[model samples]
Target chain A: MRRFAALVRRDLRLSLRAGTDATTAVMFFVVTVALFPLAIGPESTVLARIAAGVIWVAALLASLLSLERLFANDYEDGGLDLLALSPLPLEAAALAKVAAHWLVTGVPLILAAPVLALLLDMPAGGFAVLMASLALGTPSLSLIGAAGAALTLGARRGGVLLSLLVLPLFVPVLIFGAGAIDAALHGVAARPHLLLLGGFLAAALPLAPIAAAAAIRQALS
Target chain B: MALPDRMAYLTVAMHRFANPARFQRIATAILPWSAGLTVLLLAAGLYLGLVASPADYQQGDTVRIMYIHVPSAWMALFIYANMALASAVGFVWRHPLADLFCRAVAPVGAGFTAVCLITGSLWGEPMWGTWWVWDARLTSVLILFFLYLGYIALVNAFDDPVRGLKAGAILVLVGVVNLPIIKFSVDWWNTLHQPASVSRLGRPALDPAMLTPLMVMAAAFMAYFVTLALLRTRAELLNRRIQVLQMARGAS
Candidate 1:
């Protein structure tokens, strides 16, 4: 447990010191959201109708942008080899990296979503549901994205390949996360959508780490 | 062997054919039969599907698209299942031919999926009043197509062929979880796509006249896949042999 925490802290500090990953992701999120108004015009109803979908998509893309560096840096510098040789289980190590990634990228994207939602003229009723869905959903994105990152390590055109591997898997999260807001806006119960998001997170949390660990082992081999 | 031991024997028998030489011999012997069956069934199916069957009272000739669409859709799912099962065997048992099966089946599966989507769209244009709908079945099948593409890309991505195969095997296992979700998405969502007609618990809702042609076409497609996969796997093995020979020559 201590070793896992230490790994998470080490990743956090490394990302923080380098500083561009989180900021770039957040900035990308903001810029992508900002483009919607310009491209679609400032028509309130049109923007309102698409607000949930736009936010969810932009968040997904922003998280994807930061995913390439998740295992690349460590794998390149031989840090991954030492980690694999460590006494701690590689699954736990994978989980720690995913958690740290969620903290830096997912959290900021969640925090930034509501502000972007406002620009889309999203209903007042949707704010809480939007945040809640993203809060529940983004961790799964980071977890699943970690698996993609591990799978593509040292592969040619890895960044593009990672998106190809990861984006289709992101559909369920997009459906439920955006569905929650859509439900809330229509004065319907958002609970089912939120519950589904939770269900996905619960399933992904345990399974993704195991898959990522296997991929990492293959990469190292 | 006793009943419990029978399964073990079968597994052992299956593994015995994992040797490239043994597999090549068996594949070569079966290829002609498989190719003949594919041609004969396809000819019979197309004649029955296009000419022998009466047009649908409601859908008219557009119903003919279902002959191609349904079978291709079935093959798409079937091939993915085969790939996943083969990948699991490769990973756990280290069977050499299991990964080869995965590599050979992927593009064939993708082609089937594409046929399903394109024919579906053509049928929808006349029947559903649109080229496409966000129907849960169509959407999930589209996702399945993407999964095949991802598998193919991952299998060729690495400089080391063995590493690529291992990585692709893991991915196939991961993507298998999506299969159940895709199969059930229509039932859960109640979208624009028709509910299950053929695979339900009771007898299939399809009429025998319509059903026979569909079954024939499905058999033809299955044979087609088997014939192509065997040929592809044999080619892959030959490629590996040539590469080894070239490397040995360079060293000498």
Candidate 2:
């Protein structure tokens, strides 16, 4: 347990020191959302109308961009082989990596979303839903992306391969995340979508670690 | 042997081909038979479905689309299921044949899915008054198509084929879990698409006339799938043998 905690801390420190994952994701999220107003001609109504989709999609892409590094670097440097041999179960190590990934990527994206949301002209009412949905949704993204990242650990042209493998699965999260905010904007209950998002998170939390561990083990083998 | 005893004998005979060399021999012998069977069955099915069967009172000739559309859709789902089952076997038992089964089935499944989407659009044009809608079933099938592509991509993405197969197996299993959700997404939520008919319990809502060609076409496709899977598996085995020979020569 202490070893796992140390591994998580080590990863967090590595991510924080590099600063590429969180910074680049935030920059992409802001720049992409910023482009929407320019392309759609700065109409607040039009911007507000499409803001939910724009924000959700930009966040999706940003999350996807940083996904390749999740295990690719570790695998290349033989860190993954070490993890596999550790006293901590490979699944625990997988979870720790994903947690560190979420800290570096998912959390920063969520925190930066409100600023991006303003630039997208999302109504004040939708801000809370946007933040809430992403708060739930991005961790699910991290978990699913971890599975994809592990699966494509040493593949040729892995970035495109990872997106192709991961995006179809990400559709549900995008649907519910955007739908939750869209529902709230229309004065409807967003609870069902939120609940479904939670269900997905619960499912991914346990299942992804196992799948990722298996993929890593296979890659190492 | 009695009838039941003969059936058991046949199953064991089939399982004999589960050995790669035995499968190669059987596939070589049976390819002509399966090809002939597929042609005969498909021709009969198309004639009966497109010409002999009466038009629907409601959908008119447009309902004819169901004959092709239904079977291809069934094939799409069936092939993916086969891939998933094979993948699980490969992952759990580490069977080389199971890996071959997954690799062999993915492209065939993707082809069936592509046919499903195209025929569905053809059916929709005259019936639904649009080329497409974001209906749950349609979207799910589309996702299945992408899953097949992803599987194929991952399976070929590695320098070593074994690595690719292992990665691809993980993907297939993940997709299988999502299949049920995709199938039921329409029923559970509001969507433009209709709910289950052929898959549901009790009497299928389809008429007997419509069901006949659909079933025959479906059977023909299944036979075709088996034939193709056999052919592909043989080809993969041969490819492996050639690689082994090349490596041996280089080492020597």
For B154-207, candidate 1 gives per-residue lDDT tens digits of 989998777888889988888887798878888898888887788865699998
Give candidate 2's TM-score.
0.94
Which ten residues in a row are the worst by lDDT in model 1 chain B? B193-202
Per residue, candidate 2 scores C-alpha lDDT tens digits across B128-211 of 899999877888889999999999999999998899999999989987866886667878868766676776667998877888
Worst 10 residues of 1 chain A by lDDT: A116-125
**Where is model 1 more than 4 Å wrong at Cα?**
B1-11
Error of 1 at B3 (Å): 13
Model 2 off-target regions past 4 Å? Answer: B1-18, B25-33
Q: Considering every candidate listed, which one attains the maximal TM-score?
A: 1
Clashes of 2: 0
Record all residue pairs in model 1 with backbone atoms less than 3 Å apart, i.e. clashing.
Answer: none
Each prediction's TM-score versus the true structure = 0.97, 0.94
- In candidate 2, list every pair of residues with a backbone clash: none
Alpha-carbon lDDT of model 1 = 0.93
Give lDDT tens digits, candidate 2, residues A1-221: 79888988999898889878789988988888888888879878888889899999999999988889989888989888888998899999999999988888888889988888888678789889899999999999999999999999889999999999999999899999999999999999999999999999999999999999999998999
Evaluate all candidate structures by whole-model CA lDDT and list the values in order: 0.93, 0.88
**What's the iRMSD of model 1?**
0.6
In terms of lDDT, the poorest run of 10 residues in model 2 chain B is B10-19
